[model samples]
Target: MKAIREARGISLRRLAKDIGRDPGFLSRVEDDKQGAGPGTLHLYASYLDVPLAAITHKEIPRDQERPGSPHGDDADPPPDGDQGSC
Candidate 1:
């Protein structure tokens, strides 16, 4: 994500503000330290003009967290063998 964003000459601050997110939050998303919510990912896809999947290949499946459902940021991390990490 960072690579693509940088390649497109978009600054993290600019993209974060445009997509209504904090730059630190976007940084974590790029680094895979946090899982982005679906809505947040959609905003990124729209702002970056890229396919959603391109940025969400490792996102939690919608079936696991229905759209609009809340995800606790501090929830227990996925198991070591789980499909969580990108």
Candidate 2:
């Protein structure tokens, strides 16, 4: 999520404001501490101009991360990095 957001050049503050969330809370999500809900995922997908599946498909934990895999599709999260349940 963070990678896509960064690739699109979306800033933490900007994305948070656009989605009606706090930047700090969003940050927690990125660090894998908080979880982003489906609603929030929709907001992020809409804001980022990407499909929800694109973000939700493969979020796995670092421990479960597959070798040579391109991305992490482990869990839902809040903001900060929204990996999408915070």
Residue 37 in candidate 2, Cα distance off native in Å: 1.2
- Residue range 1-86, candidate 2, lDDT tens digits: 66567666789999999999898887877666788998888998788777777666455334334444455454434457546555
Model 1 worst lDDT window (10 residues): 60-69
Clashes (candidate 1): 0
Q: Pick the candidate with the highest TM-score.
A: 1
TM-scores for every predicted model: 0.64, 0.62
Model 2, TM vs. native: 0.62
Name the runs in model 2 displaced over 4 angstroms: 58-86
Model 1 stretches with alpha carbons more than 4 Å out: 58-86
- 10 Cα displacement, candidate 2 (Å): 1.0
Tell me the deviation in Å of residue 36 in model 2: 1.0
